[model samples]
Target: MTSAVTTDNSARPGYGQLLRTPGALGFVLPGFAARLPFGMLTISILLLVQHTTGSYGSAGIVAAVTGISMALSAPLMGILTDRFGQSAVLVPVVLAHAAAVGGLAALALADANVWFLALAAVPTGASVPQVGPMVRARWAARLEGSPLLPTAAAFESVTDEFTFVVGPVLATALCTGVHPAAGLVTEATLTLLGGLLFAARRASQPRTHAPSATGESRSFALSHPGLQVLILAFLGIGAVFGGMQVSLAAFSAEIGNPGANGLLYGVFAAGNMIAGIAMGAVAWKIGPRRRLILGYVGLTAAASVLWAANSVILLGALGLVVGLFIAPALITGYTMVEQLVPANARTEAFTWLTGSIAFGQAVAVILAGRLTDAHGSAYGFLVPMAATALALAVLLALRAKLAPKAPSRIVNASVSAPVSAAAPVSTSAGASAPGSEAAAGPRDRVNERGMGHRVPVTVD
Candidate 1:
């Protein structure tokens, strides 16, 4: 009988190839628009609240509350998405977010009390659509078992960094030049329109799996020990962001150029975007776990000297270095989910990592703001250093936990015959039998079943 099983020996695809995948732009564009507001929200809230209240302390507190709320709510949203599908969860969440943000802006403009503003922030943050996690989940579903999975993860991070580059600059300009509330109003508009557009792309959304007989689908992403480690690592990264946002703004004001806050933060985010782009292009030999650890080492080293920079040029230069090292760790953490979590729990896993960053940022923003107020902007710079140091220590101690519990397997599909009749394929790391049509390339192995392809059987 003619064998229907064949191996694919194709070289790994690049970003261009990944983007060219059919229907990619359908979700990518809308997802980008929806998530751009993520970069803007914190800064917009900080500036608007600080402007109205004339107190950085109150502004920091309000922003912190928002971040904390979002961090807490993200996984819950992920659970809803995993159960009901993305469109159903996103529609109401986006609408609620727009309304909440609008109310917060109105109250800020009306000189509402800090306590009232804090209360409004709860709903505003809880309603922020989990767009980033949703997009990542789409990519995972679309590219499962393909070599381009890492590139997709890197591309997502690049997209995130690009939004940070533009979002802060746009929000700052609107708040400073147009109106104190303009930044927030624009944020709300984008969240509403972009989120609805993203939700409308039903074709690109991942299929929601029904709960298993054992209800394994109902388990939380945080139940995984590896996921917990990743979340803690991400919290450190969030601290960098939170520390940078507040400290950089304070530094700019202290240097008699408050308007330069956007430019400075933009430079930092640009560095991050650049690094992400470069990371996606390279074919690294080291595994993701090693890359993650090394990335943190570089980050901690760079962040250590940030407090000593007394000049704008120096601070910006140091900030750029810090940004440069962030992408590898961030991208690796996202990429690791493929091995660490099952397909059913992937979205929730992504959100936990994302939320931990927000939580870390929330804590750092409050602490950094108080330090800057009490001492100086230089003191605020200490937060990233401390956070990174602690994260690095944890990663070093628990490095083994990051390994996958089960070996990833390559699924061979029979194109011409039923998969059941095809001979069992080797799980080893090379070519099939000598006369086979193609060879199995390393890194092309993944446990992606039920992908709507003409697959006969999957080997465990």
Candidate 2:
């Protein structure tokens, strides 16, 4: 049995090899930097709305609206990127985001109509996905089947940590010190710059899914027993995160130290980022399936601790402890998603996984806000914890009934992929020929029952 699977496309860069090369890290840094400003924008909006409107309730409404809109649009954008390519899709989206956000910033300064302000919010908010998940996808295929992939996951998570940590501090400072509008302007500028830089990156730019890639794989991704469980787990994860956002924000506000809340959120991200690194460094000797089960269970345990106490300090502390498990769990699940999905739908599969995360974050934010309004932030913790716990139990119960993760990689086909001057094949709603026929290149469908894209090893 092969210990590791290699992709059929030798031309594709491995994540491990890319990092080893000089300047590759530098190449990816801009994408990371682009996310920093927006982090501040999110919280600044929350604080600004609360202060200006004198309503934490209104702030929650705006926050929920923004988070949910982004969540709803993300998969669509992912699908667009998968269909149209990142450069084409994200460029226009980012530009629209810039205009919308800039309009909002200006509106904050001007006495703009309230309805107009809300109108602008939606499009600006939609712009967020430009630099986030899609950028991660760019590197995913580049680093497939290497230790670097986990390291890459860690790196991606770190950017998320940095964004939350830095963005909030800036938002808080600008809101209290200068003007709320300053934070908005700062966010607008940063998001525009980051989005532009990321979209412009030649390699990082999103590309359309090659047709013939997945003409036959949607059923597998949607109906495969293992995948179904994973998707449900992700849906629950979304609910947990959505709840966390509202709960954390409200909790911080109630304590009269909103700064502390940002710190707590930062710590939450930090724990995951750090753990993700360690998780990536060590190769799980166990199979991907076993790794996923352990990872999810760890997440359930870590997240549940928030319910034990409402003490701000304690929650923060527990949040960090819980966050420690998050990145690893996500990375493991992402890898599992890759393994479980058919290659034709790899982009969509990955999108589904990422979309689930965003969805979880969105729903959690909305629920947490409402729950905080009705009860308290502390109680909101139960929202995500309970949801995740239930999802886990259900997934576990059904795990055996679902197809097990293929113990070892399998390829029953004798196939060869073509190189240059690739022929283009169009696909339709129910087409399989395009994806199947195109399923041989670096663009080949991920083998659901296989480890990943496999290149047979020959012993001389």
Per-candidate TM vs. native? Answer: 0.88, 0.76
For model 2, what is the alpha-carbon lDDT of residue 242? 66
Model 1, 1-460: lDDT tens digits are 2232222222345788789888999999999999999889988998999999998778878888999999999999998898899999999999999999999999999999999999999999888899999999999887765556778999999999888878877998899999999999999999999999999999999888668786654656778889989998998999999899889989999999987777788778878988999888876666778889999999999999999998888888988999999999999899988777767788999988889999999999888988998999999999999999999999999988887664423343212222322233334544355643223322222222212222222211
Root-mean-square deviation of each candidate, in angstroms? Answer: 5.3, 7.9
Model 1 misses residue 339 by how many Å? 0.8
Stretches of model 1 off by over 4 angstroms after superposition: 1-12, 212-217, 408-460
lDDT of each: 0.83, 0.61
CA lDDT, candidate 2, residue 427? 27
What range of 10 consecutive residues in model 2 has the weakest lDDT sum?
A: 412-421
The collision pairs in model 1 are none
Candidate 2 lDDT over residue span 1-460, tens digit each: 1223333333232346546644456447777767787577667767766666666666655665666566566666766676677768767876777777677767655755445656666776666654666656766655443334555666666667667777778877888899877787777777777777776776644345555654732333455566667767777766755676677877888878876766777777777767766765563445555555666787788777786666777887787777776666666666655446544345555656666666677667766766777888877888878877877787678766334344122222212222222333222322325454333322222222122332322110
- Give stretches of model 2 more than 4 Å off: 1-18, 21-23, 108-116, 204-207, 210-228, 252-259, 310-313, 342-344, 398-460
lDDT of 2: 0.61
